[model samples]
Target: MMAGRGTSRRQLLKLTGAAAVASAMPFSAGSAVAGERRHGLSVFGDLKYSADFTHFDYANPDAPKGGKFIFRAPSWGFNQNIQTFNSFNSFILKGDAPPRMELCFDTLMVRALDEPDAMYGLLAESVEIEDDGSTYIFNLRPEARFHDGSKVTAQDVAFSLILLKAEGHPQVRLPLKELLDTEVLDEYRVAVRFTGNHTRQLPLLVAGLPIFSKRYYTAYDFKQSTLTPPLSSGGYKVGKHAVGRYVEYHKVSDYWAKDLPVLVGQSNFEVIRIEFFRESQIAFEAFKKGNITYHEEFSSKTWATEYNFPAVEDGRVILKEFPDDRPSGAQGWFFNTRLEKFSDPRVRRAIGYAFDFEWANKSLFYGLYKRSQSFFQNSVLMAEGQPPADELALLEPFRGRVPDEVFGEAYLQPVSDESGFDRTLLRQASQLLREAGYTRDGSILVGPDGQPLEFEFLSNSKGFERITLPYIKNLERLGIKANFRLVDPAQYQSRLNDFDFDVTSRRFAINPTLANNDRDLWVSHAGEVKGGNNLAGIKDPVVDALVDKALNAITREDMNVAARALDRVLRSGHYWVPQWYKPVHSVALWDMFGYSNEPPHYDFPVESLWWFDQDKAQKIGKGG
Candidate 1:
């Protein structure tokens, strides 16, 4: 469930001039406008929303559809045909791809109208849940096909599931594990049956799984599919590749589903290309030098002051910012429960008290981040204020799981410095440390072992490292010796898999379904021994029992009860020292592209209106 990518925070300052001209945003179109004329536009939206999004309307007005688009990602590799262990960028491509990927691929179901609820058919002609929600039947569009002439069959669907389940990323397998059976009724029909009662959000599981050719894959070694992508059935086919540098995809001129409602308003570009950059800073330089189409800003200083391009002033490089309620993907510190120092629930809650998020956001991120209180941010499910009648029905069961005070107003004792570090918070942290059997001397916490109760915090990104160091001072005051250690991607992965680190920072995306999360990250079974996503190495019988209740809830009421019960237990365990999340994605791109005035609730789709305007590209390059 954990993930990472790059973007800058200070986008408002860059967009101050452009917001002056836009007005009266329109509602998203219900379907794509076929036979639309081509007009070149280029766009950039953040990755979270892009995962399952394939419709062009979500991106922009479909236009200028005859040339190749070169997308630049910071990806390094890919997982075979499975969804697991692919490059970071490939991870997003599972359900959703970039502008090009969205244009190229389609899904059977998609998120409904920005609601974190259920899904609607995109490629599947119809889907019916039957037999008390234990069975699902999908009828695909009769004309769906890969770039080759072979017709898509129910066998392909079955093969995709078996292959993905066998080899895809662990997160990809979480939702489908309960899939007891999948039957190819006919060439155009498939039936999926779960182990028990199902969530309405079940179809969201099909977001990025394009049917693979069983014939082609059977002829080659499946494990090596990443290096040699099997003939795809999506919008674009592999055109060229320079290995680790870049990969190019050419649009299938006669793609069978091009005119389908699922693809409307998206896929304006005829070809898609992505150049991989080893360093993000180097990628930014490429964008400035016209080597890439856009740059997503995540740093406060860069957003406020970096876009000094003359094109920006002349409306050539337009920066766009919007307020939002969408989750920015929770990014913060996570503790390894496998480490004995943090085994006590009180210790984890005490650490949460030490984080000065308000100050961190204001001073470090220019107020671009919001403090997070729940795993699900900004959503109705988040446990906020006092537990309401509805919430209490769910939370009451796990009363002792979390602190009773957390259920009360005085739950998390406020740190002395609400905005920044305060000596008072330091003293409070020391007090908690003392209660936990640690003696503080000066700034070092001495444990029973006669050594400082400290461990190394590892991160791969410089940006995260910047935000992490501030808390070390607070830990020092509490007698805990905290060290900031930056590691490479390879070493980070090795350490995480080995459960070698005491703590680290990570963010996981939630797709409205709490069940998938339970299987992937929370269940005691997911801990290290299972080689699952139980990154925190926590194991508890109560949590395991709750996960079972959650998975088998047969009614809506039962589901909610299960959801809240599981949520309370997980939060109480304090597996992750949950941190703040940003609501809106701040994007800056050249003004050649046109998007709806309304901000996308889930993720901004850029395949619709964005096209490569050669004139604009040239003009901007000339500093015109």
Candidate 2:
């Protein structure tokens, strides 16, 4: 997770997991009747909202739509070191782009935040799948139009798929490779065919992709990184942007799908402005001064001690925490196993023992967080205690290949007393390092070639410095030269893309309903791909096999079993020094916004569904 509003790039990629599982079931013969179509689709269940249904159950269908709704960027709470963006092209692999660029484009289908794995039609009015589940046809609504008032044709849909597969980010291109071909049946209808052995989720993933305008790109270069905003069809268009300072979006008053069932009572703001700051402290100051209207705080120290400004004291600003029902995904110090020093599992496990999470949670975090024990924390997908019969069965074939402990008990992080120095854990870590070919000369641990056992802990966030400083002290106790290096956001991103770090912090978001996107995080091929999200540089064959089983799982029970197996193996490998997570979102804003009483089950789609309260805005003298 990145730190402030809207979906980050990591969140967008993780959301595809639901689509992957949704496509697991093959369509039946009766479902393929001629002219048959449905308004909504789900992976392994019936649609939550029927075709004749109005707006989603959680939506305020009659909510007034006016006033400005300002928020900040890099929505993840702790890692808020993002500075400036140079490109308007978010889908490509070139340059850093502004957050929330997806707001400008609409997908064929829009996900209902309230549902676990359901998508309703947006551009397409109805969709039909072949009996074999290999082919899907979407009937686009004739009312759909681009920002330029040009009709969104089936050709545009087909071209978007082809273009994204060829030139989009690796996360976009890898899954799209399963798409055999796409055909424009007519001006308003398109068919997508899947290759053999494709996961059921591929079709829904394809449908939920950001649909670009074929005509717009035809007149411009899609591969280059530029500041020129492309034409979009979503509820908002690019209003004003100052390269890296700020970007503003103006609501499309005559938006094509404003009244559609999936879009009803949403996109309430007339203007949505995103302001960027290089420092998290400065952004917080701006929020306190009313320059930024909405902010979701991530730092525990800030959340615990801050919010004492006059606005908060006088009840002008509202501070609230919303409960989240989804998995508390993994965030930790990821080891780059591509390096020879980190290749051994023993070395990774030894390094993991050096971090003192208990002290950090108590002293640094103000006791507001729980230790993240699983990749899928706070979710049922987590493997608990010992490996179950099913997980054991899955690991049976790779007995000698994997850690023997994986078969007996689930992996647990080393716990320590609140005191930063734990001699017991340090001794244990030293023993593990010794077994991995490191010998201590006096206080320094040396590798097989007489090189010092050292690695750089790379980060961009100044906020993380406090947390890493304490951990670095523990690493030093083990005779490990752990150096913390802070770089600019652009340089940090480039280093991550090129896998140029020995250790780095990353938060891996996981969906309750898993998807093939997990492969991009764990598979061997993904680790080899440049710009991929395999931050740990994992490339184990057994892990790859488990990922296949999880993605191809035909039933919920089977999916859980496979996911647990994968989690167990991953934990056993000790690829990350697990961090802590809070199950609720800590948010603070001016009391000028109104939202549904119920938060979405999976995500906090605050900007999309929350409306500007005209009365409240007027009271604050910031009326739109």
Candidate 3:
């Protein structure tokens, strides 16, 4: 799903370290406890919330709850123009599911958004990790129950892990590979043992897996795509849904964890409705017509030119900008390295040089975007200037395996004079392509086999065409036949899953507390997986090793060093033509909602914390 803030499950398991001793330990076969049970778990630091803590610091416990909250569904996965969802199961790779389906299920552990990497008990009351971090034991809350009133047992947790690992989507299954086995000690306690080679974040990652009702799936196929909503344990459940038009989740009045410290001042809406549209313009029209209550604008052109409607002018609709502290991860036109045309790094770099970000930012984006330079852009993990001593030490082993530029200085994107057409960069790009066994014959660039160099730029968003048209012009100038093909969401998704595209735009949202997710996107094994996030089909051993180093890093400094090393290698690969990102979240909503002043650093938990204001709702009426 492009590994963004709302999509990537691994991002939720941001881990920091913690230590505690365990008592009343029970062993099952090869499992034995080596430490005390703790109320919460972190990677290498103390828990942000104490054992006696009531609620997260950002939550407003006394906030009023209850009216309906309606908003336009945010884009999910790589293709943003998802007009329809044929299935309710978001865990699998079969169909385009509705956005925020994770809202229905409860995980064993819930992360504290304010902290960098701290998660407290949710479905599970407490967690115990072995001293060596190989084994993690979770004590399920006896009172935890699914929507149908079925008890959430340790067996359910075990079954969920097994099911997800075996049949869930590549994003869901890939991260669980380190989990050796899950042992259900009793109705309430479950022990998850990991392979010795696993990373330190494995425990926290496993703990954050969404627990499904084992009995519910027994009546339905876990692998097949279906519209039937499964039973849920969270505060909301699938209420009423039209197969393509819209899906509404109604809050469970008798939710089991309503008063839980982790859940207090959250899930405030009585009903949360997500409506779909075939185009962003259609969605914007719906918002203007009051069919949609809230909108998070993505296109900078729209944000600047649009929004002059009567409602906005009358003060009924409020436009606000929120600060985002999370990493503005890499978003770009990713090349499919599996194809022979893109096999050479020089060819990829030459193609990247064709994208004029400076021109696009001014002409297309209304100068509202920043040129992305790193995989972990806008974060401390980003590699700056040259390689530091620690990062160089990490990169020294594979000197010849990586680009020579990696050792000298940080990789930078080709900059232009903001003229849309830069002759200097074009000349450099032409030189690079010529060096990579491509020669200009008449008007076409012919490869070593005398075949013309041509490729298709696939996209689902029509809005992207404005950006791609300019880039395509430059590619054409270099004798590269590049055409933009806008397809339906389903076809686009299928093509991406099968690696059938020559080039496409994708965003890999970097987690502040980086973990094993790097492997899922850049490692050798993931490139071979059909639906893995390695969109560029990266299979470099150096990248694989750097990902491992980052995952197992013991301290924040070590993690940054490993991450920066990995970033330098990836940037050097030129697997993608870098794009742009806005540091602030552009949000416009009707005045009928109330929310906490402080937003979470990692994610925007809009539906979870924002509640309906009855007085404002009455004044604004149902349709703004």
Candidate 4:
């Protein structure tokens, strides 16, 4: 019943969930002046670790790493797909790239998962910001080198940013719209200039972008989808890979930044491998037979009933739950508002009434999930109860254009009686359709243009058929012709990119400090972009303005106020049929991996954080 989750490291920089009150002040000019060298950049306030720190507190410098870890990708970000891949050029919008492709490339700085939004220098040693806040000078580490041993220079850094803005995927290109230019100051230093009107977090966004070797791309076409791995400068290098079957990333023994404070205990596997299965059942079977070493169980039914295998009995397998402290961002069936049939808010609201989340949680989900009510579900950024005085004051400008409910109480989804069929909610749905100018034409709900109100739910996995089919059945009672159309992985992604579907589902991750690029999900222009995240085709001026206001807030308190206001407006739109969420990470793993036991509050990058345990491996009879 769940959808693809994003595991992109960039996902962390852009994620927004619960905001933590900063103990320190927001960014100030005292340490930000042009020649002062600070080791890290926090969007707000001071760095948690001093410049002289050795490693991130969450990482284990003493953790051992020398085993091959193969698992199915639970989530991915950007143009990455967990099922299949057709390109090595993950930055572009043309093809499907493998999850974890970002592992092969290093950014100027890397964000810490433990913090809300603090990034430490990786390729760059330290950054100096101009008083105007539009200019940033990054002092690169001289020791940083590409996998091929070429020095990572300022020209490459400048080239990478400019190239991404011009031709990268829309997600990568979204925040770069503020870039004025990137200038090469020296062999190991670069200057990036942004438009004066850019958001405060835009500078950090620029620094987190992946740096490419100018010499390598100069010889290859950066826009084309190819199987040949591009030249990168990250901790791991692309190893053996089958086109769409699997990919292996080998740890670089001589990686220049291996001893850097930011990466001391991360990327622990000697070889990290990802296995692709077009079907979930097949993927689970592979995990049961030991082809996959780690599995994040998404199905509550599977977790409840399917763990009595011989391995589990013998203690060779361990079932664990990791606490998800961050906000579970938006997850639901988003309507394509580009089409005239779905353009009306009333009609969209009517469709949402047909989904009985309580029945689904009992009959299908085993009562392990909660009905998702807000786009910022489980976060303080979510709007709840009534609009508070602060939020109402900020939202006062858009009074006429937005619904009155937004000013009254934050909209909550209608509750069903858990009877699988709620006649009262269905009657309300019928009334909404009639008000929106839809008429019942003897078993078919016809729209204003006299066309039947029919839309197909596009899907790639058949696992959701049970859930979607029942929803479709409910829609049928309302005289709405709905269908669940399953397509292949590549075609599903293609249809989504082109905005060709009527309805589709997705789960977005939000961190305390939101990703500046998340603006794509609500901005007016991104809705028209060929491959952007505005899947519901949201192009409202209020949403666009609210996105800017939220991202531009300098402090956590201000950000939460703005975000809550934005949430109220989005919920009122009925852009998505809100789904369900669980606050725990249900995972099953082989008894050979070791971690800090307590995962970070903001992120869960198990591949990088957990290491191979030799003693544990021997105990489980999985010794290499």
Best by lDDT: 4
**What are the per-residue Cα lDDT tens digits for candidate 4 across 1-624?**
566575343522352122222211234554376667778888765678888989999999998878988998887877788889888888887889888888889998988778877889998899888745777899999998999999999999999999999988888887788889988888888999887767767788888888999999999999899989889999898899998899999999999999999999888899999999899889999999989999998887788889889999988999999998888878899999999998999999999999999999999998999989987899889888888899998788889989998998889999999987799999999999999999998999988899999999988888888899889999999999999999998898899899999999877776677666778888889899988888999988888777777877777788899999999999999999989888989989999999877898877888988999989999988887
The candidate 3 region of ten consecutive residues with least summed lDDT is: 15-24
TM-score of each model, in listed order: 0.80, 0.95, 0.94, 0.96
Candidate 1 off by > 4 Å = 1-62, 67-106, 112-118, 197-200, 203-208, 410-420, 441-443, 513-519, 529-531, 540-570, 607-609, 613-624
lDDT of 1 by residue, 428-512 (tens): 6667767877776666677655677877788766666666777776666566667888876555655765667888886655434
Clashing pairs in 2: 3-76, 20-201, 22-43, 23-200
TM-score of 1: 0.80
Summarize candidate 2's per-residue lDDT along 1-624 as a digit string, tens digits. 223332242224431343344445465443344457878776664567888888987778988888777767645311122478888788877887877777788889988877766788999998888747788899999999999999998999999999988988877787787888899999999998887557756676788888888988999888888788888898898888887788888899899999998888888888888888888889899999999999888888888898898999988898998897778777888999999889888988888887888888888888998888888889888998888788898788889988888887788888897788788888898899989899988879898879888899998888888888888888888888888899988889789878999999877777677765656888888887777878888888888788877777666688889899989899988888888888888889899999966787887778788999889988987775
What's model 4's TM-score? Answer: 0.96
Model 4 residue 557 CA deviation in Å? 1.0
RMSD of 1: 10.2
Clashes of each: 34, 4, 11, 6
Q: How accurate is candidate 2 locally (lDDT)?
A: 0.80
TM for candidate 3 is 0.94
lDDT of each: 0.55, 0.80, 0.80, 0.85
